[model samples]
Target: MPDDFSWSDFIQRALPLAILGLALIGAPLLIFEPEGLPRMRSLSKELAQVRAENAELTRDVSKLRAEVRELRDDPAAVERIARGKLGLVRKSEVVFQFGKPR
Candidate 1:
């Protein structure tokens, strides 16, 4: 509106603000675009896998605890383990072998 308001003056006044606005808009992309998003996705997948493995291990531990309790409190369970794992027989029982000859 004034005679002294020239193109140079307009550029001088607008350049710094334009630069600042562009920096504000572009800083995040510059900082995060290359690696941050992909790394976050990778870490999220790893966390999910770890949680799944942890749940499976927790189930295994519970099963083992139940087996331990059964083996401790139930004579039948102990006898089964002994016969199946240790090949033990009662004193009154006779052993038999019917396998093919080696």
Candidate 2:
């Protein structure tokens, strides 16, 4: 054994602590932390929700385009839509109205 401990003893003690400090500091970036983890998960959920809504909107757009094409090619579909949406009646047809209580 040596009578006096030198700088090597201090360095050997510090090396483990330095490694532990680096692990602590780098863990949050490499692994998920409690504070930021929930935010990242929420962002992923929101992105999924937005993608679903986008898909729904895209389907709605395609459906509307198909309806527009139908209205352009089929006069019967146009007439049906006009009668249903605008309450249009034929030249000799009489429409009866019944009131319902709200």
Which candidate achieves the best lDDT against the true structure? 1
Model 2 Cα shift for residue 53 (angstroms): 0.7
For model 2, the run of ten residues with the poorest summed lDDT: 29-38
Query: Candidate 1: misplaced stretches above 4 Å?
Result: 1-27, 99-102
**Residue clash pairs of candidate 1:** none
Candidate 1 lDDT by residue in tens digits, 1-102: 987889998999999999999999888886688577777888899999999999999999999999999989999999999999999999999999899979
lDDT of 1: 0.93
Pick by TM-score: which candidate is best?
A: 1
In candidate 1, residue 2 scores what lDDT? 86
Could you report the Cα RMSD, in angstroms, for every candidate shown? 5.0, 5.4
**Every model's TM-score:** 0.69, 0.60
TM-score of 2: 0.60
The models' CA-based lDDT, in order, is: 0.93, 0.90
